[model samples]
Target: MLTSAPPDDASPPVDAGRSRDAADARFEALARMARGHFGVSTALITQLDAGRQSILAGAGGSCGATLAELASCGQTIADAGMVVVADTRADQRLRDHPLVIDNPCLRFYARCPLLASSGGTLGAFCLFDDKPGELDDEQREFLRDLARLAAMAVESDSTAARLQEEADALRANEGRMALAIAGSGTGIWDRNLQTQEIHYSSGWKSILGYADDQVSNRIEDSYRRIHPDDLAYVQASMQAHFERKTPSYEVEHRIRCQDGSYKWISSRGKVVSRDSEGQPLRMIGTTTDISAMHAMSERLQQSVDLITCLTDEVPGLVFQYRRLPHGEAFFSYASAGIWDIYEVSPQQVASSAAAIDAIIHPDDREAYRASLDTSAASLTPWDLEYRVQLPRQGLRWRQGAARPRRLEDGSTLWHGFITDVTDRKRIEAELQEFATTDFLTQLPNRRHFMKHIEAELARIQRNDGGCAAVLMCDMDHFKAINDQWGHALGDLALRHVATILREQLRKTDMAGRVGGEEFAVVLSDADIPAAMAFARRVQQRLAATPLAEGDQRIALTISIGIAVMTASDASVDAALSRSDRALYRAKESGRNRIECL
Candidate 1:
């Protein structure tokens, strides 16, 4: 039903202006071979120009067609490789094609591109059938071989001359190709599954420390060379490909070298030929030595594991902190101890320090930022002790020390450690309290009390209208009390008087047990009359509150002397002597009375 034209008499000439008869005869032989090999009804060697396709030669009653008529062949040439439509009517791109809907309706079509020696696609070697059919792997490979022949025929003046030239070029490049493959530590392999014979390239033999003549070509010999532990795995991988469960065979395993030691290798292959039942008949692949890569990977893992172990065992949070030039800061690395010190996980601060910053005591956060800024500016060591109010631990102290380094990117990185120092800080505070406090009454001891007096005197000397009074008080009948009630009652009496004095004083006033059965008070900002009134109140309170224990009552009284400490007094002793003289006169008169000097 389809029309055909006679071969164009004015068709473009073939390569090198070969006679039309000779070129057609050469291509006709290749076309006939393709038809017989694939059992197709027709095969055509066609040459394409911009407008139309010219049949250079034909087999099985084929004729010339235009480029639009052989749409599948044009696609093959565009693909620059084999293209097959098992059923043209079943293909979306070709279902409406002219050749598929017309007389001699093409049902199946397959073609391979005819590549010129210059690597450009010239046309395609095409097959056509009136019935839908498919090509197996073996048939596909055969079609490719035939297409290669067609390409050579189109490029050459004579087939024999082209073959000789190809042979000479192959001989010339063989050494260089082998050297390159050997230098790259890659080897080629071909296996005939039917014959159970294998061939290795010279480079492949050299990988195992063997010369080309020293290695065996038998497939069983190749199996024996694989390490015993890896042989079963390698066989399983290949079997999977043979069963068509995998697209190709690929595996990494050990193989025994010529010296009886093992080297790691990676093998990859694909089935190139198969029998009628689809069982693989031949395979081709490459092998690469991977022992060096494997060893380096193992060493890298060991190093990572070692560093992890060391960091976990350290006592504090060992960390790396980075501050960008734009003033953004984060901890790049932190050990597990971050949980113990900051009550937060390491991951919480990995990208931003905001989580850690939120826990810092509000009063100390400004100081913390300032310290870091100063250190970064000076490129100096960062050392700080600050407080944090953690969710789990409440207010706690942390001590951190680090050395800052400027990175090449104009950022700063600090390698540092942060530790919980709350316990140490508590102990220091307790020691300080012990040094300044009286053991019996918990008041400021004489030494500490004198420091306050000196400070008050200095304030008065500053001439700011500051006035203060110093009072010296001595217990009357102290010897009699100790002898009658034992020193235990005497000490209780002293404590009882101390309690009364403290209760009567204002926050600005200070009292201390200055000596055995003697006490002193400094009334800040008080004149002599105000000081005398304070002394009389203390005397009356002690008289009323006698020491009573187990129905035994012991009366207590103290004689207080007040001396106005003027700004002219150079030292604390001047005021102390005046107060003592006044106290003597009060004791000589009635005890339990207040006097002033």
Candidate 2:
């Protein structure tokens, strides 16, 4: 739960008549502004008292509950800055609170404090919704701006009430009226529309760095001091108020200061008097210098632009990924390169990762999810190489690397990069094939075959009861064929025999060329009878097929010797030696017949 400060006691009590009505109107306007700007379901300006919080103004819903039941606003005031809860149900501090469990049932909430000029937090400007949501950096800054405006409106209302109470006293002392206006830190203006003359207080002249006598009372002179770009907008606002189209003339624009530099200012006024025909006769308002706020907004925008430009130019998908405690995940920020990597736009996955997940290879999807879960649990750097089936690229490989950090909200956030690694994976597969394959026959070479037999021997030892057979086969009179028909035909004959071996063997069997004229085979889960049957099929197939090149027909035959591999066998070489001895016996017994030992 969040620690909250005691309620502020510095707030002045609000009076109940016209002053309260005016304050409510201003507060409602600000609440509506907050609701529209944030696109939330509800917005409110709430004032906090000793033990209760009251809603001064609300938009989108009505609060029927008592002031004491709404404790969130008091917490916001104690925060003294912005506070965001992405999901109220996921928060320990609010999940059991009455406001969350009852009507409105808020899930998302964001609040900014309304601070008094005396440095006390008096209330809060808040936005909320029934669905879980979050805000970006720019949205947070905009909320702060709205909160500042709400605070200023509150202060202005209080000051207006105080001045009205002292109106009689001020009328008796003219100097005191001027002092009160100046002390409020804002300038006052009175305009006579019929006479086309304006009167400004000493505070008003001082805002533009001018003495009271140095400025003119002519309305045309005031227009000349406004920046050329802002003249039309200012004039339009003023004309609208004069025609009674708007309730007030309120505008923020640039004005030329005494030093000839433009400074931003906010001007507010309303017609206080009218003629018999309803023509505007007089207007009164206040002006506030807002150059500092305008400058800060400009700098913030520049920084945001710079960061966006840099991230867009990166070659891979640079992103911030977040995984909630409930196993939900999304990409909060993704760079432009997301299009090339996942074949999906960044905006498509900004709120959910389902679009990207749909493209992952079905066979690899489980491993992908498991890898992330492990990394998130341990808070380790995640590294994964996975395949994806993209719409445009077909089958492709991707490599991702990220560092995970646990957040205060029980979510894991990662700063990561994902890049297309299809080319690298293809190269690695090709290199592996070259190392293990016999180039001419496209079968396993001697070294790879020996390693395969060793693995089989280990498996036999582990299981202790399965039987396998190793066979050694020699091509009959290979040397004579090479000498008479040339080495090329002899090589062709060897490949022909290799093809027969492949065609006759079971899927579980292995075959490889171990010598110039010799081949080896391993039959898994086979006994003596099964081994002899396989040898006869290979010999018959070889004799039935002949190599014929331009009417030269050559019939080939292979002699096979089979030896059973037993669990008692010391090594793969021991089984091979027995098979070799059996081969010599087959050759001695007149060549073409198979022998078993």
Clashes of 2: 0
Model 2, which residues run further than 4 Å from truth? 1-252, 265-310, 324-329, 406-411
> What are the lDDT scores of the predictions, listed in order?
0.79, 0.82
Best candidate according to TM-score: 2
Clashing residue pairs for model 2? none
Off by over 4 Å in 1: 1-304, 462-465
After superposition on all C-alphas, the RMSD of every candidate to the true structure, in Å, is 28.2, 12.3
Q: State the number of backbone clashes in model 1.
A: 0
> Clashing residue pairs, candidate 1?
none
Give the top-scoring candidate (lDDT).
Answer: 2
**Residue-wise lDDT of candidate 1 within 1-597, one digit each (tens)?**
111322344323233232334546668767766775567778867766554555666565322343234533334223566888788778775675455556345778888877875687667788887788998886886677666666655554333354456547788475555554554457878899988999888778778888889888899899999989899999999999999999999999988888888999889999999999998999988887767556644644665687768886887889899999999899998998889888888788888998888999999999999999998999899999999998878999999999897875889989899998999999998887788777777777889899999988998989856679999999999999999889898888888998999999999899988888889999999989899889988878887898997797878889998898878898888998899899988888888877889
Q: Ten-residue segment with the worst summed lDDT in candidate 1?
A: 1-10
- Against the hidden true structure, what lDDT does model 1 obtain? 0.79
